[model samples]
Target: MSGIVIVGAGECGVRAAFALREHGYKGSVALLSEEMHLPYERPPLSKQCLPAHKPIRPKADYQQAGIELCLRTRIEALDLAGHRLLGRDGSSRIYDKLLLATGARARLFPGMEGAATLRTFDDACRIFERLRAGARLAIIGGGFIGLELAAAARAMDVQVTVIEAASRLMARGVPAEIAAIVEARHRAEGVDLRLGMQVAALVAGGVEIADGSTVAADIVVAGTGATPNTELAEKAGLAVGNGIMVDSRFRTSAPDVFAAGDCCSMPYRGDWLRLESWRVAQEQGAHAAAAMLGAVGEWTTVPWFWSDQYDLGLQVAGWAAAEAKTTIRHLSDDAAVAFQHDDEGRLICAAGVGRGNRVAKDIRLAEMLILREARPPADQLADPTFNLKSLLKAA
Candidate 1:
């Protein structure tokens, strides 16, 4: 049948299907997934949903929306000329328009039999079950995933040890000053933090460091980042970089075929940037669907991501310039917000951490200032007495 065929029924696929309907497209939508479960969220895989699984949308909901759920279906290859997708089981289907949202996969350590990586519901369940009381959990790659899993493990009374190759936690995502706060918080909660270390081998007990130290872990988990699933796109002869390259309108190199989510890199700041974030995936999916419907729209939302570890919550809005000047505003002993400004003192990004709603107001204000490209004096930004909301009046 000739209709819209969406491969990989994750957040991007599901959102794109609904977005098509929203954009007034009355056509058949087929959502295909290699996994058997319904479309779901991935961020919760390392957090609360690990203990209790939650479906993204009910089966009945999909039916009501006229979205055909093709479970356990794998598209082995694509025939661009014929608009046919060859399946692994020898099944074939034609599409009027195709949306590739294959997403990404965990970058695993080769020959590591005991270590596990969290990317799907099944992976999360297995990790949760293995995190028993007094169990030694060793996590490699001190990124957000590793640190978040460490928090979850510690909550279950498991002895947590985080081994990061970098000098600080979440080196790529957070600033050095913010990294120190995260390290301090995790350490205070009894997490064994190993920084500036490399895993030479994964033994039975745990991973062996290059420095000849072995971390004793009954269960070893690696959060060593992910790689985009762009093989199918590449086989179809689409231009691929870090991900499938798309224009500001989310169109791939081929005609009648588009890409989105983690698998596709959209235009950002004069270059192509792929964001593996839930929020970005959803937005791009919707925007891509809209573009497929002949709507003129660009994916230009400010990148936002957050992490909740223990009682502290960290939220970041906008992109952080590498050489930006940073200023800190402390609200209390357990709460503070950091702002990064460009050379011209324009607000580029802001990060905040606190127990509850202490940072909420600042986070909202920062997001607004970033969108407005507001430039405030470094002295005013660092002064706790200076009202951040006052900028809105002149904004």
Candidate 2:
């Protein structure tokens, strides 16, 4: 069976497999997963998959598509010269082309045996068991995953105390204004947010702080961050920097080997950037499949991500620099939209927070402007009376 061998079974790997068939590729496809379960989406793990234990698709679905699903299989060595992949259990497979969709893994705290990180479905199940009513949860990060889990715990009637090293929540992703809004929302939802705090050590009951303070919690979870799974690529002598370095076509330095998703970093805006969003992963996967079929085109889609907390929805499209000129538009007393532009006045990113429908509309307009790199006056953008939909016509 020599065709395409995808090294991972995450969203990117699964999408690549389906995309190959869609693109009229008659070659065989094998999706290898180190886990026993079928390929599943990770976003639901922090949102609803824990409460509702379900698989994204049944095993029969893959079989019907003529894709081989190799479960609980690990590719220990990559013989790039021979186009062969050696497995740990003395199994080997030859691939005409290889796609490295090996996604990232959660960062675990040292000596924190009881603390868990939500990366896999199994991890979500364990975390769900611990999130009982009246149970105290101490989260040790303020990123999206940590805050989302906090909201989920609060919904379950579990007391949550978030310990963040940064002064604001999601400092790396959201701007100051958005972070303030999110922090306020969490506080109103009865989430005890401990900002500018560091966990010196994790004890049985809770965690010890840097200032000789201790918070008692029934369970502790760390959502610090994720590290790219690039060990296999590095071992195969591929160009590894921050992640497996790939070009705009998802082609790696090694011939006939392509990488996508969180495992690969591509050149963007004169810098190497690795996006961990599910949408980007799927898009890159499809693009990679097209490139593998000799239909190469540089990926040019704008990146966007969304989060749901309590009753509010937040959406951001494209990248916003810290020094970028910003404009704000208010849809209501509590709901607002914002746009960021570079010094040259080109729209770089847009963010909105509001009810589902309103935010979705605003985000769509902003995404259009970003895709076009449109430069509109800051005042005109901030005016709520202005019709943002008109930008699409102008573009």
Candidate 3:
């Protein structure tokens, strides 16, 4: 049976089914996910949903998809050479094509017996139980996940301390200058930020620091990094880098087999970037489905990502050139925009915080600029005389 099988129920797997049907791919589709519950959104697990004791999923979203869901089942192994998969029940099924959308898991608080993570539904429940007011919370990483949790814990009147091995917050995502703003804001909220502090060991009691200072806490969390669930493909001898390598078409090393979302590293232009963002997952899932449906297309959408924290909504669009002499404009006390250009003086990235619709406008423009022309820096672009609508059209 020329059926398609998806090995996960996460955004990538579910969205691929939706996109396939929406684009007129009617082959048999089945999704195998280990989680017994419906696919829930993970973005808010660290913020709104976790603190409110709410499920991150909305029921209405998936009820109409009519996608076959196999819950409470884990994939035991993948026999790529035979074009089949072995499930937890020792059952095997042959497939004409397959997609692996296995997402990442939480970076655990290593060696801590009672250490908790906020990745899955179970993790959320486990972590929330320890969020009582006056309870001490020790976070091992100061990235977005850790900082967002810090914000939530602070709002709940809990004592939160984030130990970052790096000097800046979200060092991987945000520029150093941008990270400084967040650091200052977190300090104002009374979040204990041990910058440049390394956690030497995780014990049943608490974390042991390199400086010999022990951080005692009821809950210990790690937001250090997420390792992608790519064991099946790797064991099958598929090429793997930071993730399973795939072309713009989303096909991996094995023909009749594909990968998407965070599990797949895809090429964009000349760059081989692996984005772990939700938007990327949705877009790539659709592309993979399209390819299965005999649609020839490249996944070359401008990258867009957003993060919502306490009174701060950060949105990034396109790629920011680090060395590009750029301009910045403070749109308001709580809002700002930056225009990044290349050495040849062409705009490459349009980034903003708060009032980020400007970046969105550029994205929606039909004739996208290749950034070969010189435009005024951010300050001039923010001037009242500069009509955003015209620039949006020009873009």
Candidate 4:
């Protein structure tokens, strides 16, 4: 075998290389990255990597893992029919098996230039340079990425106001009540949130809303969300709905070619859907690696994600249909839970804020609910009597 060729050197891409070696695959691993810098951790690209990171050992170890890396190269065209790839610099590459982890790119505001987004290492560096001590930043969107930027800006003592087109903060993912709590925390930290406000335009020094009020700032950061990189797959004529379609084993339309990370769409709950969560990126990458190595496992995984904003930590596990019945629970008067139902009245999703460990337990419940392995009643699931895992094992 000629080894595995991995694309996009981010979290999923790096993990796939490590996973291939960890699973006892004896073959060369090649990674293609367009970034000039070596493959780096992204979570901190928002948190600490800009200024620097606390524990820098992981960054060093990741490179020493025996994976060959090609930096600053672009794979312009993927010839699936011929089972070969063409690069931007006119080089040909072939693989025994391949993984497309091309990842996601930031959605830009069409008319805006000189704007900033926190998607890649370069974006983070640029954003950091503009973050002078007293600079005012206007961030668009109120999702996890946007809120994380708010926390980072607030940490640097910069003035920031987040503009969300949605009615509430993180309304699409978090439960309404939890969203409200997150909103309060951010506001208390002096972050001005313009909810239910659509951005009409991004200017040189401010944001003009659809309502015609202009919010001034020294810099503008847009976190409107991500659009998965699907052009290469689409051009190759793969079954593309929201993303490159894949099966439970992370196998793509072409049997020998697979896709994972943010560019992949797989079965969830039942039908095919695309997810951009961190867990999805990780599990799919590992599963795709296994599938490529001829040792595949069931890839149906409990989707989990967490967001840190101000002093609150929100964790969600499992998929919650937008129309599912939702219940709100309060751990303290300040901390709350938003639980969702999916017609069977089973818990489809749970979002919580203000307590990380508390939310961790409920997340476990949400996972069991998805697997239909939780034997306790719904009341017990919501009970604040004890730790979630303890309760599950106790009862």
Give TM-scores for every candidate, taking all chains together and pairing residue i with residue i: 0.95, 0.96, 0.88, 0.92
| Better candidate by lDDT, 1 or 3 | 1
Model 3 score (lDDT): 0.74
- Which candidate leads the pack in TM-score? 2
Best by lDDT: 2
Off by over 4 Å in 4: 53-65, 111-113, 373-376, 390-395
Task: Encode model 4's per-residue lDDT on 42-100: one tens digit a residue.
Answer: 77777652544332125556567767778898988888877777898999787778899
What's the candidate order when arranged by decreasing TM-score? 2, 1, 4, 3
> Model 3, residue 89: what's the lDDT?
88
Candidate 1 overall Cα lDDT vs. reference? 0.85
Show the colliding residue pairs in model 3.
none
Per-structure clash totals for the candidates = 0, 0, 0, 0
> What's the C-alpha lDDT at position 37 in model 4?
74
Number of backbone clashes in candidate 4: 0
lDDT of the structure predicted as candidate 4:
0.78
TM-score of 1: 0.95
**Model 2, residue 273: displacement in angstroms?**
0.6
Instruction: Summarize candidate 3's per-residue lDDT along 181-218 as a digit string, tens digits.
Output: 67777898899999998888876557888899888887
Pairwise TM-score winner, candidates 1 and 3? 1
Better of 1 and 2 by TM-score: 2
- List the candidate 3 regions with Cα displacement exceeding 4 Å: 49-66, 108-114, 320-326, 355-385, 392-395
Model 4 quality (TM-score):
0.92
Alpha-carbon RMSD to native, per candidate = 1.8, 1.5, 3.3, 2.5
